[model samples]
Target: MTPPMRLRRRVRFVFELARAVWWLTRIELGLRRNDLPALCAKLGIECDLRSAAPPATEYVVLPRRTRTTVLACAYAVARWPMGSTCLRRCLVLGRLLRSLEPVLRIGVRRDGELSVHSWLEIGGRTLDATSANYATLGSP
Candidate 1:
């Protein structure tokens, strides 16, 4: 790649990362202050509060390259100070990759104590490693 092109890509990546972090912050704050449905509404995600399956709404389909870039940014921001939980990560990723039809899943397990986990999936494939230990409760 040309020097200018490389620089442009880097700039775009940084911008995407910043945007992801901003959204993550917003989601974290919303989770802390409001209910799930309210947060989803605020983020412009149409969700069915009564269903465990992924949202069944059409979204603006993003290009595969753009979706990949956004996913990279989302993962990068997952290490931020607030310590991204799976739920937060899924929420941010789901928002960023809505066009790809990401599903946000929550599961629970008991290994002496109750543990809950969340993850994102697309096309029946999980974006993150999920423990076989947890029993799926449902998706949001």
Candidate 2:
């Protein structure tokens, strides 16, 4: 068996990764682009008080995206809610995602009448919204 010290290190690494995942998941729940940099900075500080290096800097610089594509295609048979609220939620979640995965790009745009959307993507994979050529709106 590995030494206790090595085992402890392994466990700690796993724990930190898990913590990162949890924080990102929460962002995926609800957050705004402007609200993310500070929120993620706070989260990183709390999660790793021992480290002097800051983590939030990376998230603050990522780009943004806007999309109104459908969500949960597999659940199409289940008929899920695809309303403005859902798209808005994705936008909020995109903010959190910024901090979690620095590589994931983001953008925001508005559609017809009072409609705004945000989304995340990496290597052409749609993380939040569906694949639809929604009308190109504006950005922030």
Candidate 3:
């Protein structure tokens, strides 16, 4: 790539990184304040609160390239402050693909130690690195 093109790409990446950081912070704050409903409302997204878990096989996934882009952006931007990548990345990816109607899922396992995880699923397919590790707690 030409020097100017490389510079432009770098600038675009930085801007996107900043936007992802802002969304991550915003989502974290919303959760901390117990204000996710309000946050989603503000973002013009309808929150689907369900007490039932759906079958994991019930989704028509987007194209492979789209999924790759979403995951790449999530990992690239949410790699910091390690150990909490799932939720933040989910939120970031959800915001990025709001039109896809990302389904946010929380899963818990308590055999040895109680652990909870959050992830976003699009078209029924989970969109996180650890998607297979957890059972969905409710509809996502």
True-structure RMSD, every candidate: 5.1, 13.5, 4.0
Q: Give the winner by TM-score: 1 or 3.
A: 1
lDDT per residue for candidate 3 within 14-110, as digits (tens), equals 6666766677767767767766556666544444445466424434466653554464566565565634556566666777678878777767766
Off by over 4 Å in 2: 1-34, 40-111, 128-140
Error of 2 at 55 (Å): 25
In the range 86-132, model 1's lDDT, one tens digit per residue, is: 77776776787776776565677778999987665566566655434
Judged by lDDT against the true structure, how good is candidate 2? 0.36
Q: Judged by lDDT, which candidate is best? A: 1
* Best model per TM-score: 1
> For candidate 2, which ten residues in a row score worst on lDDT?
66-75
C-alpha lDDT of all candidate models, in order: 0.66, 0.36, 0.63
In model 3, which range of ten residues has the least summed lDDT? 51-60
